[model samples]
Target: MARPSMDTDTRPTRLYSALRNIKWEYLVAGISGGVVSTLVLHPLDLVKIRFQVNEGYGVTNRPKYNGIVHALRSIARSDGFVGLYQGVTPNIWGAGMSWGLYFFFYNSIKTKLNEGDSKRNLGPGYHIMAATGAGFTTLVLTNPIWVTKTRLCLQYDKPAVSTSSVHYKGMLDALFKIYKFEGIRGLYKGFVPGVFGISHGALQFMAYEEMKTLYNTYRNQPIDTRLGSAEYVVFAALSKMFAATTTYPYQVLRSRIQDQHRDYGNIRDIVRQIFKYEGIRGLYKGLGIYLWHVTPNICIVFLLYEYITNWKSNRPDNHS
Candidate 1:
């Protein structure tokens, strides 16, 4: 038999083609947006986590929060101004890694689903699938970081530390300590609720993409047309609110499961305790604070992503 033609032998495999078509700009923009947003709003994030884990079980050691204002002032007065940013290190790392990987994987999967043409319009179902895949991947990679961040934030800077309370000097120390003490299971304490939380991202992205597509269609532009900052802000905020409102309960569950102060048997046990003691409102404990923290966060991330991608696409060298 004759040897295969040079063209046939040199043809790139499907995997190679897909890998080569991967647009790295999305990852860069996402990492940049995530780091910047976290730096700006980490205090609110700390407050949100604190609120979520506070179940009013009469834990004398931890500080009590009446509301967002009280929580901010109380944390500041007790732990000083620096205390508000207790989990900044791990939060930044987790946010940056998560957003970067999420956008990369989401766009990559979307491209694959569209048969290598990323500009092709995908339905809401396809968008959800892409976002879900990205969210799951990002969660697996960053769950340990989030667990460390939660523990770090929950460490109060009081004069008398509770015997049950675990103090971590920093992110690495916390990770090491958790693994040393509780093993891999400790790092993934809230993994089940976290899996459910993927719906948050999936819904947000699906709504976001649909809104953008509709807006562009209304304007008689291509589906993938670049949008203005205001447009991005509106779409991002709306989509984030939609997702956060629907999935806020799972967040409370995740925080409670990961909380160092309380150890429930499992997710169901936690749910039962919250329901029995706190009722339906307990499941949405920190929703107000969460909205305050996350709405601006999504806006910033989307704005940065859009602007950065637009600039990259318009670059002279990129055109060449």
Candidate 2:
């Protein structure tokens, strides 16, 4: 039996051959990983966003959440277990689509850059460049979903009264309201910070790729050989932690900018206010929870993505 020839830029792609061969596995794996991870860590994500936006204006306002424990308890007592999973609909949509697009672009770009070298790791530089491309592309396309998700998660038992028409009933309603009232600009509020935050993925993918390469080299294994699930978890956790910490402040700013309950003037104004009112500690409001939430979530996603992609790749004549 003959092996399938690798697709290269030089070769003319015959119809959906490239699509059938290389793309579907990534799409399935990425979307599946993203949805599963979001469901598991959504409560913690809600808590993190709440804490991020809880700091207020006047001295009298104080902060709504003192810490993670207070925030979690407050949410559970007030909104019940269901409240913790608020915005999950859009959250799932955003996460799944973002990751799906991310992996597609990541693998696509990486393949293009690799030319025909199907046998070597692309190293850190190529990995960074490819990841940056994927991050920027995925984030821009999915920002609207994220905006809607943020608004939903920020909701409390008492609905926020926006001069803008109606309150959000669900994902579709939120998107419609945001469009009707805030316009396209409203849906892209956090775009600048989000663009800046793209480095998180770039840095993360670079680190993850490098770590995996090192791990493989250390084990004297080939690049195509699958690592144990535990190894995947460790590499993913480390990469996610690095990305989250480095880009965390942007997460706070993004939440506030998207919060229907609060209004922050501008990035500088928001930065100044948080620094003045809540101090340095305020900038890192829910980082502990974020790290806790993201580490295992990424671990799950990475493990599943790698395994699924590998399984499909190794299967005979398994085109999409």
Candidate 3:
């Protein structure tokens, strides 16, 4: 036990290992899966964003959208079909960067942390730690991308003026305008809550990794080895649902902070204002829509990721 605990050679140096594991395949798999899923599921993501920031709570001319169908109809009638994909550019960028960086850091960290023995295994706690590290690193690097995405997604109400400050034509446009008007800090609007939301990914990966480990044990196979697509989808869906359900409220708060129509000085102010006006229920405004949106999204992403990683691992040069 002492010998195993003291094993130093298996422990990786942090920076070099991370840099070395930055494979192009990870980027390809993550970007491809994210872009595909966002294309299919962006409408739901838009609805959830509208729901979160719609503090009017069903008031006339203020309700944004009465319900899902109503929201869909409203977006179509107001902004046309493209409205459904309002901030899709930044969303693609964000989603692609997010998952790409996440998988890269996650696998690198997992490989480093995994037990250096024949019967290598990791429990839930280790999984959580690895995911937490990965999540934090990804969030810090990609917060600006996410901030641009949120603003673009919520820019549904078009102004009559072509040069209106309200509209963001594209991702690069949003970045330039945000820097000009709100300065560098504007691009980081919801960064605090976004950081807090790291728990969501941490919890998701922990549950996902643990579930796969348990499944492999039951099947008497190497951990996460030779799993079928259905199994991967099931594990991905279960973990995503769990994480989203448990850590959703922070998303609402983050959305509110990032809403271009509203301005908040701080997270405490946002929370207090929401509590005063919207009450406890306000915290979970779009959970239903989010669940509907995130469930399939995660499943599709992991299904793609699993297959992609499997292919890479089975390549001739990668074999032991």
Candidate 4:
């Protein structure tokens, strides 16, 4: 018996066509997966900061947690589980917006950028451009949530944690409280560093896209069949490490700006104060923590994203 010929029209020609056909199931799956993973992993983020900022206080010590499990246990012992989830609500909002927008718009933008050029996939510039757009958009949209989260997370160390000091109980509370207290300017305390941290997104997406493309090229060679789960994990770790290292100082500044007290007039004055007190290093107070936090976070994020994308692509109805 002769084999049947495949129909050329069955294959998608335009990238937008493929993106347009993506089911809501995949979008939901991606967003939910990101949320769960972020919430679960946030405690390590807390511990990483503790270690990072300790150096500033003259506590030159190594992190107690060698891995996530140890980090959780240490944090629970020291500050309780509530401590582990100090800023969870805002974390949820920030992660939801950041990841949701990044994935959704990245696909849409890449599709549009590469329109009529199917053979040539999106390059590093496309990844940078897509991430830049997503970064600025998410920064503005989620800045209030992030400010609230920072206040909540850093509030624990204060002698008295008053509602006046903390200000916001939840997302909506934070938004309304800021507006009532400081007007429109309250929501944008760290606009400069917030925008600077957009470079983190640009670097992250650029590195991830470039690395995945390299992996695809390597896998196609006769010497290698495909990347295994372990290979994927390694690539994710390396990509995150590079991105985090390159853009970590901006993150530290963003946290400081967002977590400032009412005394600080604005971002410019705050930057000046940090420079006056701590010098250039003051602006980068929690850089070590950021680096540690981002490596595992990005690893999980990309790993989950790839798995979700692959699962969606393999489903029956995903076909054109």
What lDDT does the true structure give each of the candidates?
A: 0.90, 0.84, 0.82, 0.66
Summarize candidate 1's per-residue lDDT along 93-182 as a digit string, tens digits. Answer: 999999999999998899889987747898999999999999999999999999999988888754265556467889999999899999
Candidate 1 has an lDDT of 0.90
Candidate 2 regions exceeding 4 Å error are 1-13, 58-63, 159-166, 313-320
lDDT for model 4, please: 0.66
Looking at model 4, residue 221 earns an lDDT score of 44
CA shift at 59, candidate 4, in angstroms?
18
Q: Taking the tens digit of each residue's C-alpha lDDT, what string does model 3 give over 120-188?
A: 677888778888888889888888887888888866554664333567878898888888898978888
Q: Please identify model 1 stretches exceeding 4 Å from their true place.
A: 1-19, 158-160, 316-320
Task: Please tell me which predicted candidate would have the highest TM-score against the true structure.
Answer: 1
- For model 2, what is the alpha-carbon lDDT of residue 12? 69
In candidate 2, what are the lDDT values of residues 1-320, reduced to their tens digit? 96666765436666566656576778888999999999998988888887777776542332388777887788788778887798999999999999889998999899888885656789899999999999999988999999999988866645463343357989999999899998999999898889888889999999998998888888898875677889888989998998889888888888888887666787888889888888988888778888988988998889879988889655878754
In candidate 4, the residue pairs with backbone N, CA or C atoms under 3 Å apart (3 or more residues apart, or in different chains) clash, namely none
**Window of ten residues with lowest summed lDDT in model 1:** 157-166
Sort by lDDT, best first: 1, 2, 3, 4
Q: Tell me the alpha-carbon RMSD of every candidate.
A: 2.9, 5.9, 6.6, 8.8
